[model samples]
Target chain A: MAVKYYFYPLWLRFWHWLNAVLCILLILTGLSMQYSNPDFPFMRFDLAVSIHNITGILLTASYLIFLVGNMITGNGRYYHLNLRTISTELMKQFKYYTLGLFRGEKPPFPINEKRKFNPLQKISYAVVMYVFIPLLIITGWALLFPEITIHDVFGVSGLHLTDLLHLIIGFFVSVFLIVHIYFSTIGATPLSHFKAMFNGWHKTHD
Target chain B: MMIKGMRIQALIWMFFFMIANAGLFAQQTDSIPENVKENQKCLKCHGNKYYSYYNDWVEGDVRERMNPFYVIDSAEYYNSNHKTFTCIDCHSYEYEEFPHPGYLRMEPSYSCMDCHGFGDEWAKFNFEEIQSEYEKSIHSQKHNETFSCWMCHNPHEYKISARTEENIKEVIAYDNAICLNCHADIDEFMFIAERENPNVLETHDWLPNQALHFKSVRCIECHAEQSDTLLVAHNILPKEKAVKKCVECHSDNSLLMASLYRYQAKEERNKAGFFNSALLGEYYVVGANRNYYLNLISIVLFGLVVLGIGVHIVLRIINK
Candidate 1:
């Protein structure tokens, strides 16, 4: 039997889709500015700077909204970890994805009304959301207002350090986006998760 | 008792001598022929190629008889615009005396503006604009010791760049050398600065490709005030106030457009294709020098990512 659950709420769904749009725009504009050239431009130099700045500001706002919504909503609870089961459950989920799924073995953790994310999803989401995103945002803000950055740290210039950090983190986040989108197809149907984000319902086999 | 009394008398004599000859040391005079003759007499000792600090022993009862400040390089003096006019043309007339009146040393020194600012005779040199910019410089901010143009520009050897080579690289080196003479030397910097001198290399380590930048541009490109009136801005800002943002130079509206490249021939700048296209003819600035190959590489890499995603989707469909 298959079941449909009202897993993603309206506000969470809205934030997720909005974030998707903002992230894509930011990625394009950021890459364009970073790779801009005089002889052959990825985009017009002026246009890249303007678009990157504007999109980055918008993404900052979206990030804040996401933070505030998580604070006031039940969706945040799914991100909370169970220390006892974390390691064991994470291993189980990893194996299920890597080999068990193709071998037609049952999933170690399945989505239900009581649980929104598997252990692997919870840990990865927590790291990307809580750690990488915050760092990126901080470095991004530091770049925007260079005066706020430290003048020097261990003989390294703070601005250069900040710029390098932003570039590396941006690259990782971009890669995560690619893999995240691909894995979105791993549900019961390839388009099932995409539909759930739009309609706030997740259909699962019971 | 007689020897003690003689020593006391000698001490009193020395005090009175110093008090009486206080105005004697001022260096210059106004008469043209007399100025040359007088200067030649003084230069016999002062203009010695090796005249560094003048403390040679003299056969006299005098203590500290030689004035270290009296030494000036004859080569540099002759190289200056004031060469034919003699030392006394700028210094006090009392300097003509073999043992100058010490009180004359207390007289104010003559800056270029003493004569140059007086009329339109040297207006073409833009001394007025330079003075105006200098007035607003961080160096001009009130301190224990007054800062002056002579600190950075040794008037004795400062050949006006505009009158010399327009090659610009040499001009940049000459101008930057003046700043480094003080900044790179802690002992020299201490004369003007109250705080401990910053380590130049450490302070500038944040500057990307520092050696390239140092060689290519004047220090004033980042440190000096940006002004519209002067060809080269003279108002040096404090370090904290200097341009720190990379975008200040890296962007399309590069500050170098008004500064470093300002001397570039119009035809050179007008040969532009895109932003900083003309700039590539001379040198490569990291952000400014956009290359076709790099842009293509980026496009190819991004296309590969999207293509990989499409391939995975196709594989998934086949499995389904």
Candidate 2:
């Protein structure tokens, strides 16, 4: 039998869509500015800079909303890992991805109404939200207010270090985005997970 | 067919009109003044030859005498920015007699300030402040060391505006050339160098890459007052007062930023004011410049990540 469960909440869905749009815009504009070939202009240099800065600010706000929503609605517990079983569960997920999934084995931990993500999803999402995204925000702010920051580090100025870190982490985010989109299609139906994200109900096999 | 015929007739009429106008414009520009043509004769002797003589001997000692020479190669003079101006515009005195008056040598009155010192255009630039500052500088304080503006700059051959990075660097290199001409010479620089420092390299040891610093940055940027404007400060400080702190030039709002940048757009300047990285387009500083290597690394990383995702997708499909 197939069952319908409320997997994505209204606030989470709104935050997810906003974050998704901003991330995609930021990545496109950021790449356009960095490469900077007039022959292959993605947009005018000034336009790219303006759009990138505005979208970055919006993304920061959306991130805060996500954090607050997670806490206030008690959705934050879904992300909490039992440290003792974390390695064992991580290995099980890893094995499922590498070998077991190829032989038609089921996921080690499945998503439910209470537990929103599989073990793999929980670890990756937590890291992206808590670690990578925060680093990007901190570095972006540092780049914006270079006059007040540490002026130089390791022969390069503080501005350069901030740019370098931002670029490095931005690469990781780009990779995460690609992987996230691909993984979103992994459900009973290709559109089932996407539908769940939009309407808050996911179809699960029992 | 009728519209095409009309277009051809219009094109022919326009071509003939352009030809007639071009001829008229050429005639207008070709009319040089009668006085300017007459002054070309003055270059016959003064422009083609070199003159040298020795003077100021101590007890008639030949080795200790000072040698002075004047040579203005016509080829070089014609190439100068001041080539269009007649000689009398600058040497503003009456000396038309066959034998020039001896009083001309007695007076040292020719000055750029006579024309460029005061006026709406000149006063707006504040060149008078620069002149006053120059007078108060360490170079002016020395009793025996008298230097003129011509010593460092050729009034004839100067670039007022360097629009490109290469041009800006070339202008800086030319200005530094005057200092290097004397400083690189053991006989001229030995006295100054010894009084300043025993070791030239050691004096500038605070700079991480002294060679690169000297190559790109003007000497006055460190040895003069940090100017808010693009012009170099004329009040040259003593060696003791020179800026040595690394942060002054390394920071986001660097002291050298104004003079170091050239031909920047208004937007670029404004962005730089807010401590933005948009101004990094023209030049590179150690920590302040962007690296293309990071972009290459990002591309490779993206490729690897995509490949990993592709494999994951293929396996999922096979399982399904």
Candidate 3:
């Protein structure tokens, strides 16, 4: 028998796709700005700057939605995984992926009403949503209005540090994006996880 | 009888004409600014270079230089910041006499602080702070009496271009001209300097993009002590004490801010936003004002991501 869980709500599904589109736009524009040649540019420098700023603002708004939605609904509890069992659970999941998955053994921790994500998914998603995104947002805003930033920090300029942090975090987010897409394919079927984000139902075989 | 009557009338008319002429001349002179209308009387002789000559001690040697006291470039004076001023406004009233007395030559010339030092009109220019800074400068420290405000700023020709010019490049060129006039020209340098005038180009050869640097910023930006309250610093540091470190102007907290870009920084409401919008504007400083560590990190991180993905795909295939 196959079980269908109403995991992704309409709002979450909408916000996810919106964030994905925005992230892609930001990445492209960001790369254009940092690496593009003045004469032969990937995108016109001025145009890329405008698009990046607009998309970043949109991402900020979308992030706020995720924050508020998590606060008001039960979705917040899923990210609050136990730190005590995390190491053991993470190792078990890591082993299962590397060994048991190829051997066609049963998943160590399958999705349930109580557990929306396995340990690996929970940890990575938690880090991306709670830590990396917030850092990127704060640094991005600091860069936009640098007057508010400290004049210097331990001899280095605050603006320089803020810009550097923003770039580093953006790079991490880009990496997470690639891996996120790759891991999404490793479900009951290749496209099952991607399909679940659209139709708001996660169908799994028991 | 007719000749006698005509002679008598002519004598009476001549007497009345002399009295009226004297009264009219007095009235006209009193109606005009006494010193203002007299510039032509002075410029007629002073404006012509060959009209006067003087021997002055320059660098301990007697040099027969043209008497600057009696000769001035009228065209330059007309174009100066004090173009509207009368000569007497800054000089003694005794100079109106011909063959000026030997004691009159000893009369002290007015400093910029004499008139600009007092009153609410000049309070906004921070002339007091400028004076204080100038007092501390190497010029003042070494040659207190010899180097007046006229040395760096010839009030006769200086137009306050740094404060008034619409184009910054023009301001830069005009400001540097003052320094180069003495530093670069051998004859001019000889007037003050005891040593040989070294080639300015060779002195600044260590600076990358020497021509661009000269055009981009005033000489004071590196050579002067920066003040938080002053628009342009007056404390001219000695060449040995001048900023030689590349990072002084190249780093994020560039000295250019305290010197060259101070006005723009003060005026900009949003500092980062202003730079962002003016990415291709005149404010853009390439190579100097840049942070590349993040860029390098971004490249390395991206490369690692690709490598990780490649290994992941290979591991999956092996398992399959």
Candidate 4:
């Protein structure tokens, strides 16, 4: 058996980990503020607010960096949404997860330099990266700006609709996490996919 | 003969004295002629003569009259419950002449303790103590100058129904005005704070105005109740409890609560580990009080991170 070489560049790995950690922190503090029960007083309300704002700014900056880096590195090609290929790829990935993977088969698609994500992953990541995350950042920043004014952001005066949109997008991210976990388990072994992410190599019977 | 003569003389003298006294008594009675007639003459101008004495004389015509002293209603004395009793019944003193009301005239006033004989018990009511404490309160200093014992506990209408929603709203509005009157600066400050921290959603434009903030929320909104079991009090709550209280209104599409929650959540999370899932989730369902769907997203994010790391580590060990 030889190991397949699907290199995740050092910058990509760095950004991925940083984004993951920061997003987790944001979500945790965010939830605390939302529920605000006595038991969850990880931070005082005022301090949590400052931290959430700072972290949000950091996340937005990092996301921009990632975007620019991808474009510069020519890795942005991986994000293209080709409908014909994506539709077929998504169907095949679904079948593998639902039936084939359970029957001790390999994944229908393989990770390579050109195609980093399976069809489902590509579509989901595109939505999260281009659509949802950007919307969240804009709304979150607009919320921060007293000058921008909530009315200016959404043609309204209060944060109700804005909060709802933020939460709804957050929900999508959570669903993505669950499916991501399940797929990780479907690797060559329960832990193999996780290992590949770190070492940038996967074992395959040639 | 001398003793007998002395006795007869004494008896004759006693008899004469008795007759003379009787005649004098009758003449005196006739001359007085029951001054009730004179009192009736005075009553002609005094409306509702019987209740006149009970009227709030301090605020009544007596205080308003240009003439400091005018007895327009003597009927109050004649037709009162003490009608058979003279003015001296309660006064216990008589006016010898006009303009000289008397050296020590009792004021027409009574307390519940006076008639009920609860003087001893009334002393233990500790009203003075409560009044002193209230006088020192921010509400007292900011609002009413004459914040007496009767201000909150109206002596005439001392009922707890003052806690009703309508009454409370009125009180809150009044109390808020007190703050505004003194601290106009707070309104602008809050406006800036709200604008700066609009939350992740960009829905609203400005924070609620000073009037809306005070009336809609109170000091207790952020400061928890003294008693843990009390859900709400004086419209304030402990910060944690306040957040929970907001759920009653903000959750489930409640615009106010939702906006407040988002702003708060972001703010709180920024400060410290106030809402770290690893810490708070074990105590209770993290999302039960939250937007459940959003919580799910958080969980998923967490799971993905875990999976990514787990797969990476395993593969590394195997390859090595």
Native contacts, share recovered per candidate: 0.04, 0.18, 0.11, 0.05
Model 2, B193-244: lDDT tens digits are: 4443235567677554466577667777777775554355777788898877
Instruction: Estimate the lDDT of model 3.
Output: 0.77
Taking every candidate in turn, the Cα RMSD to the unseen true structure, in Å, is 14.6, 19.5, 18.0, 22.0
lDDT of 2 by residue, A58-112 (tens): 9899999999998899988989978788889889988987897688777777666
Tens-place lDDT per residue, model 1, A1-206, is 78899988888888788888877777776776665445455676456556766767877888888789888875788899999979999899988866676567777887877788989889878888888878888888887666667856774457666765776677667877887898888887879999998999998854
lDDT of 1 by residue, B80-106 (tens): 666677676777777876467889868
Off by over 4 Å in 2: B1-293
For model 3, residues A1-206, the per-residue Cα lDDT tens digits are 67889999999899899999999999888766655454444776556667988899999999999999888886888998799999999999999877787777778998889899999989989999999989988987876655567756775557666765776778888989998998887877779999999999998855
Off by over 4 Å in 1: B1-319
What is the DockQ score of candidate 3, to 2 decimals?
0.06
Q: CAPRI verdict on model 4? A: incorrect
**Per-residue CA lDDT of candidate 3, range B1-320, in tens?**
99999999999999999999999989988886644477877776677755442434343433233576557887898788888888877877677775566788688777899889989999878899999999999999987867888888888788886556656667788888999989998877777776789998999987654665686678898899999999888999999989875445543456777776666556543343323221112433422334355456667887887887787668767776
| Ranking of all candidate structures by their DockQ, best first | 2, 3, 1, 4
**How does each model score on lDDT?**
0.72, 0.67, 0.77, 0.52
Q: Candidate 3 — which pairs collide? A: none
Tens-digit lDDT track of model 4 for B67-94: 3232333433443333543333333244
Worst 10 residues of 2 chain A by lDDT: A33-42
C-alpha root-mean-square deviation, candidate 4: 22.0
Q: How high is each candidate's TM-score? A: 0.51, 0.50, 0.50, 0.48
Q: Which scores greater on DockQ, model 1 or model 3? A: 3
Cα-based lDDT at residue A115, candidate 4: 66
* Candidate 3 chain B: 10-residue stretch with minimal lDDT: B272-281
